[model samples]
Each structure stands twice: as C-alpha cells, then as structure tokens.
Target: MIELTRDADVAMITLRRPERRNALDIEHCDALREAVEGATADGVRAMVVTGEGTSFCAGADLDGVYGEAFRESLYAALRATLDTPVPVIAAVNGPAIGAGTQLAIACDLRIASDTAVFGVPTARNGLAVDVWTMRRLVELAGGAAARRIMLSGELFDAGQARHYGLCDRAGDVVAAEEWATELASLAPLALAYNKLVLNSPDAGVEDDRLSAAFDACWASSDIEEARAARQEKRAPLFRGR
Candidate 1:
C-alpha cells in the first residue's frame, strides 16, 4: 500500500490504502521501507511521504501490530527510515496518530496541512511507543511538550504542532511540493552529510557506521559535480553515484 512517483529530482511516496486510513500493516510497513531505500539508492535528491484521502496515516492497523512478531517488524520499518541517509520530508495531510506520528518524526523535515492534526495516542490504545520513537519525540518537541502529548494523550491540531516544534511549517499540499523542490536543489553531498551529523545521538554512536557514511560521500561523484556546477553558475545534476 505505497505509491511512488519520481518527478524531477523529488521522489513522492504516498501511503495508499485509504480504506484503512493508510494504516501500517506488516506488508505496508515493509513496502514503505523498501520504497524509501529504493528511492535513495536511485538518486532521488529529496523525498516527500504523504498519505491519501482524509487521513495522512491513522497509525498501525491494530490487527497487524497486536502480535509480538508484528510489533518488532513495525519497529524495524520506523528505524530504517530514521537512519536513512537521504533527506526525508513528511507531508501530513490529515490526522497523524500513533505510528503515524512516529513516521513523521522519523523524517528530517515535517510539513503539515492546515487541516492536519498530530498525536501519540498509544496510551489511548493501551500500548506504548517504541523506544527510539519516544527519544525522537523528545528531541522534536522538547521535554515539556513531549510529556504533555504522551503523558496526557492529547490530540493537538496543526497550530499546536507548529508551536510545539512538531512540524517545521503548516500549509497545503502545494506548500509541501514547493518546500520539497527547494530542498531538492541543495548540494546532495552536503545535505546527506548534514543529516548524518545532525542525527548523531547525545549519548554516542557506533564508529563504523559513522565512518562509513562520512567516507562514502567523499568518494561520490556528486561532490565534484556540486563544486563544478557551482563554479559554472549552474544547477548540479546529482546522480547520487
């Protein structure tokens, strides 16, 4: 239940399955992870994830996530996107609840429509959010705001989301497209490196993964193309090679 489209340098990944509010089933979650990874590997300069219909994502399908195995699998999908190299932008078109909010938080940037709402209602569902998602929520909205949402299980509207720093901006789908285009034009190498560095944990990170990500960019042709294109006063055509 994922839809993928490549326009210019932007890869738009839409969560389809509107009948279920684009809920995350095991297959949908797996497909989403693969779709995002595929887009990054295919040299997509930027990625925008949105959902179809009245809800951006209603969260995990209870039937799919109830089992222990499914829970683990769902967590894996969330972690994959959080650790992905390329920039990920979330376009919240409607209510982003539970795992829906988790997915948005995992992205590098969040642009929500004026009609959108965000919440972590795991407590409402008699459940709890994944550990990494909880940490990222704290990082996004700060301790006080995070506690307000998670502890009290409040469903905040788009304005509250912006106020709490849960989203970077609030507008319509058009605004999301515009923002994606602007971000896609940046030097891919620098953007990727910045994402890597900025995502570094406060505690610590494995040296091997950090070194590999850093070293890989230096060897990418995108770096030379970025410099050359800048010097020539033209836009760089990044192949992500």
Candidate 2:
C-alpha cells in the first residue's frame, strides 16, 4: 500500500506494508505511480519517499515478481518518479533491495538512514534487472561497484552506499524533510529544468529541448526576483514562471 501526505510544499509518499517489509506488488506499484503523478500535477514543489516502520522496500513481492503485470506496474512507477518535474528525495529507512534499489535511484537524491542497506542481488536469485536499471546502477555507483553488487550479490550499508555515490547522505526522514524544505524554497523552474537536463540520456549534449530550458531559465522572472532580493537583502520569492 501507499500513503500520500503533504507538509506545506513537500509531498511525502510512504510505503505502508511493513509486515512484508514493504515489498511491492502490482497494486502497490500502480498506487505509487498514481501518487507520484498526482503529486506532480498538484504542483507540489518537492517530494520525499520513505517506508513505514522498518525496511524502505524489500523489492518486488516474491510471489508476484515474475508476473508481467507486476513488471509493467513496477516500471511504470519508476518512470513516473523519474519524469516528475519536482525534486524527489528517497529516504531509505532500512533495507532497500532489488527493486527497492531501482526505486531509490529513480529519485533525484537519496538520503539513507544509518540502518539502511542497499543491494541488487538478482544474480543470487536467478533473476535479472533490465538494461536501464543496470545502467542506472553503473551511473550512480561506477562500473566496479555495480559489478560487485550484481555479480557478487553483496549488500552495501549506508556508508558504503554513500562512498559508491548511490546515497547522497546518511540521514533519517527528518534530514530528508529538511532537504525537501530547502529545495521547495528555491526557484522551481530552474530546479525542474536542471533536473530534466541532469537526468536526460543526452545530458551535456546539444539539443533543442536542453537549449529551450536554458533559454527559459535565463528569461524567467525568477532571475529578476533574485536580483531584487539580493539588493533588498531578503529571500527571493520564486513563482517558477
């Protein structure tokens, strides 16, 4: 199950099936996708995803992991998170294994608690993640780390995750919330455009989409507001226009 809540401009999505270590099924994945899409559409400036009780997410429910519907829903949920305009911070509370790792990487940033652990041990279970998922792991943790995780099937603790660049910081939900609050106060248009460019497959490449976003940011009213705020010695109020 998925629980959606808002605190000012930050939306929180909590995975609620602690009994099963928050393992996701088709229904849960669908709900996650809906919640993320709805929150983005509703204009939430930032989002934090965490799990109830212990265990961020244990990955796909073993019973349904092989089903086509479950795979479809899981991918859909991940795509929704990746495509969200606002920033998403994954607050990894505990073990984030298999699909759980995928979900965390889908977010723009990851803040893991001291107790959090990460891994994608599909090789151990005779399962395999998709090309995109594998590439994402490589991008976050580097080729050597990714190889160790997938081939060796080893779980990495929070410290190791941070060292590998899979986790941005080691912190709890409160820390994640603090980060979300800071992100919410920044220029929304700039953040959205930057996130799009950073997450694009053609990042750092010349493209019309990237050029347009750059142009829009330069021409945005937020730029003037920033200048005025600097002169007034006050915080800039960005409308994201």
Can you write out model 1's per-residue Cα lDDT over 32-51, one digit (the tens) per residue?
A: 98888888788778888999
Number of the top candidate by TM-score?
2
Q: 217, model 2: CA deviation in Å?
A: 1.1
Tens digits of per-residue lDDT for model 2 on 157-235? 9999999999998899999999999999999989988988888976665787788888889999999999999999999
| Whole-model alpha-carbon lDDT for candidate 1 | 0.84
Give candidate 1 misplaced runs (Cα > 4 Å). Answer: 202-206, 215-232, 236-241
User: Which predicted model would earn the best lDDT?
Assistant: 2
How does each model score on lDDT?
Answer: 0.84, 0.94
CA lDDT of 172 in candidate 1?
Answer: 65
